[model samples]
Target chain A: MFFNISRYLGRFKLVGCVVRNFLILLVGLVFSVNALANPNLGLPPLNIPADNPQTAEKIALGKRLFNDKHFSADGTISCASCHQEDKAFTDGLPVAVGINGQAGTRNTPTLINAAFFETLFLDGRASSLEAQVLGPMLNPIEHGLQDQQVIVDLIRQDRSYTEAFRKAFAIKVDEINISHVTKAIASFERTLISGDSLFDRHLFGRDHTALSSSAERGLTIFKNKGNCVTCHEISWNNALFTDNRFYNIGVGFKQLTPVLDKFIAFVRQGNNPDYFPLTAVQRSELGRFNVTKNLADIGKFKTPTLRNIALTAPYMHDGSMKTLEEVIDHYDIGGDQNRFIDSKIFPLHLTTQEKQDLVAFMQALTSSKSPNHPTGE
Target chain B: MFFNISRYLGRFKLVGCVVRNFLILLVGLVFSVNALANPNLGLPPLNIPADNPQTAEKIALGKRLFNDKHFSADGTISCASCHQEDKAFTDGLPVAVGINGQAGTRNTPTLINAAFFETLFLDGRASSLEAQVLGPMLNPIEHGLQDQQVIVDLIRQDRSYTEAFRKAFAIKVDEINISHVTKAIASFERTLISGDSLFDRHLFGRDHTALSSSAERGLTIFKNKGNCVTCHEISWNNALFTDNRFYNIGVGFKQLTPVLDKFIAFVRQGNNPDYFPLTAVQRSELGRFNVTKNLADIGKFKTPTLRNIALTAPYMHDGSMKTLEEVIDHYDIGGDQNRFIDSKIFPLHLTTQEKQDLVAFMQALTSSKSPNHPTGE
Candidate 1:
């Protein structure tokens, strides 16, 4: 009877072990499913606009509209033409090339992880992705649509588009408008979250071996001696590589002050800033000043994310630096001297090895598989 | 004794069947392996330059070199910038956008399966890929390299390149030159042959069910009613979709004839035609006339292969047409009127359905996997 009791206890213990293992497996599957939902980057929940929720139909319609040239007045430029997937969604040019090959003053910023930004464009004039959409579409130098009505009319004419619009937005054909267009594109853009970079693996993934010694050294320099973390922040859980704040590093500062003065005078004259041509706004190089009209924000541009920095070369506001080495060298020399230059812009006497390491670290920040990349899944 | 005799006869028959099967297997293996050796495109043996034989080291070096921006004057543009792998080696621009946003006259042509071409470039001025490499690199409007020495010097500076050159060509560090650069690039380009479309699978792989029913009907139209086979040659064994010949389709005829006359005059004045800049040559729109200077060759561009044609859009030498519909429409009307137009080019009175069928057939010619496309393998 003692032997039988002992045997029963052993079977109970075995069953307990099986139940425990099954629970662990269930937990792992749940964790993996959650991970799959947010983003590969392992960042906090994405900043999805409340008005525009993501849907499959919306994304599909947005992709089609993005590729269609008929959206432009000249029927030559599509959004994809400039925001090319292969080039990390930025045209590889010093300035943004637009309708009839007319160039804008500012560099075409990468759309990768743009959903996280507090504002859009170098000047931070636009508050939301929706507001930014029409700025380019109707800009004289960009898509050059005569008006928003042109796009609406084109959509109305297409039976397929009408069906797509109705399905995506639950609206009638006549109700198809810019709100739907921007909402769809914004939804699509939000999905372009390039995460799971080797750097992310090293930190959040708890994989110490993910980074090479060179990349490790670079990370140290970026955080500590480099002082890049001040602007391009690293939070406890994630690294966005952008503080989403504005500062002047002395690039085009001297020239921009005069333009800022002119802009201020124009504002005093009761001129609506919206009427300004993109070229005029570009010429101002006013940066954050355009948004607030504050003197302190003069010559200050938003800090761009260092993610996928390798793919989107010709860095900074005007795209003056063609190589990472050039950008590093610019920082090392404490930037070009100007009155508006931020106090934080100081020289870094980095060793050659440190510079190489820093560049390597930045490169490591690049995603293992950029979702919107040409060859990416 | 009777049972043994019958068994021996049965064994002999079995052995005979085995031998015949083995022979068939050997032949099939040899055929498949040979097909794999060159490219998926069912073409004749590629015309590899004797001086620039393909090597793993050379191809690797070439790929890096193709992507290196330092090869350009401004250190911004790379060969791969305009000839992007995502867009089948052609930039999406109507005309090639080069260094400092300098636009070229002709459309950026695909480097895919260019190993089979008798000539390179839209005008066929360059006879070999090796010869073609320097044209773009040194063109003021393209890579903007001041001279061939710039490329040679850039390679010499890089330690990795010095080692790569030695392994590729058994050359000393000092021996690195333009010839080596072109040889390496050309060798790499030769490997980019994307074939194996559904059409190819049907024709070569003997997969009858590979093509959609619509595509099959389109193929019949392409061969018969469409008469695309006249220039885009369709042989029983293979379909190159190019006759390896030139023909005038009335594009740039009047303007080119005047320029051709001036070129003749310029040649008469002791100016070596070869000395003209690519921009000048491109401006002429002389087509094959630039190479041979023959009156019959005027306004005659080389017939480009239809392989992966779907990806390399903004078609034609000038890139005037943006869509497949526009291209088909041009052909349906037997091209615009010109004195030098190919006699074989005549009106195809295709119904809307037939036109759609023909377009579908041409699209079927596109590779299943564009070798150089960003999304492709």
Candidate 2:
């Protein structure tokens, strides 16, 4: 009897140990999963290239260079000329007018939250913001800089610029090249992120009062019936508002003519086929195809985050849509029917009340008012 | 000698009193000016319309209605379809998609900071968010609700909804109408205002390190070289980043056709113009003109604040420009030659460095990361 009792105690002890181990393992898994989903509700930090580290001095020097309009062929346009802060870093125009009154095919994108973008440009031609920084400097339709030497010379001419370069990069004035300029600008770009939206408050902050019942319902529809989550995935915790993927919902491709296709092909190569030089038409397409050169990518564009959608209007890569209602209508129709339409395109068949609820929910995503600092020191 | 001394003391006393009063007056003036320039950034306790005081019950009911996919024609989409919480209450698309795969014309604007907007929509068509909320519901391309009664019937049929309505508004479930729906949704929307960008930190919080040197330069350029301040007026203290005015920067008017002129004329009639349905072309031309009915407002649109321009891209009223660089190029040329161009449109001669600096500065305008509190509760 004593031997049996001792055996029973030992068995009990084993079971207790097993239960404790299981609890520990479960806790570990939860933590690991949380760590994996490093959700940033707004823009993520800009990814600076390994070759270039961001320094205060370089960023300052780059900023000075950016505000100067001498970079353009006509010497009448600076990067700031269009990317105005008051206009949300955009020129507030339907289409961009380039050097010498040259009109570009697309509208300017705001630099706000640009740091988080995987590929830059409407067509995603540039893989990095640094690469994107230099595109307009040389584009004949844009700043129209004569060459990299012009930028180098301009920086060399300014003593303040030279000193700034030295302070930022520890490089001699002559060594401050286009790559460094782009790098510095890119570093600054990393700082642009807007996170504090009401939606964030509602979801992550657990502020039940932050969202109204209508908005809460709208959120449910977005996640379920609307099928918006399929493309614009709302991660486990953080909601960046974008999946950062590319899709073609058929905006510009109404009737793909052979000529248009050929032009697209030429532009898809981007500036230099050997190196990739995008033509006007190809540049017009905008998004993934410009970067990948895959036929499947035709009319495909990168999915942008919807952090401040209410402020921006005339939506789409082409800016064809006029209002949010119109945009909703287009989506209801499953996008323009084109040969290369994304498989995700399907009719939502929402009701009028449901649409209103969705709009209501969207309006609830805005940020609350807070204090503001003075603009100048 | 005693008389002389007494006289001198008397004079001194009088002078002191005069100086003290003057100083007090000056202080008062300064305080008043400061108040005018920089009012409290916090919004007044969200003005739940008198007819629809927000209640936990009403909000909950609204949430249910918003999420109900049954509101859609096909029962596949709900109010949340286009506006997802994780995506800052906007579907991460250049334009919103709606029922039956109907593509929307405008990009889904983020609800963040929406409470501050004086006007709603890209064209400023809706005067208030409440009015705007109902727009998508009736649109064929969006939810396509069969009738307003459908909403009422749904709420009436559901026991939970009926109880919720009673608890929230002290109204019978039958009383839940379109007006009540919009008011509830608008109340929720009033909560969506973000005011915590790095710029905000530097400006309001006195965190000098919040912005990089590039961003500082960009601010300077934005105020000066970029000439952005002309349209995007910076409040002396708080920076909502908008002037809330309308201007035509030569958007969407290459050469005004008769149809365009007629539309412009129609818009010039101001609010409550001859009520008539517009053709699609006329609708396209009806930007700010639709709101004000002034010829000068032709092709003009309400100025959007530059709070989160980075996140909501494919910039401008028409999402025409793709990059900030392209936008700058447009301003460099003062837009395409047009009749309605704002006097503000003038070539800005900036250098490459300046442009880069401007881009850097604009990038700084983005908000920083923070905990999202969706529920204010």
Strongest candidate by TM-score: 1
Which segments of model 2 are wrong by more than 4 Å? Answer: A1-50, A255-279, A364-377, B1-377
Candidate 1: tens digits of C-alpha lDDT, residues B219-261: 7667555656646765444567776777787765666554555
lDDT of 2 at B103: 72
Supply DockQ values for each candidate.
0.00, 0.01
What TM-score fits each model? Answer: 0.45, 0.42
Q: Chain B TM-score of model 1, please?
A: 0.83
User: Each candidate: RMSD to true structure?
Assistant: 33.7, 30.8
Considering the two chains of model 2, state its CAPRI-style docking category. incorrect
Residue A110, model 2: lDDT of 67
Model 1: DockQ vs. true structure: 0.00
In the range A1-377, model 2's lDDT, one tens digit per residue, is 63454555556787856655666687789975653233344333345677877677767766776778888899888887767655556676666677898877776776767777777777777878888888888888889877878888888898987888788888997688877788887777665555556667677666677677887887876754565654564543455566566777777775344445565466556644324344565555644655676555667777766655555555677667656677777877778876566645656778987787777766665433211212110
At residue A22, what lDDT does model 2 achieve?
66
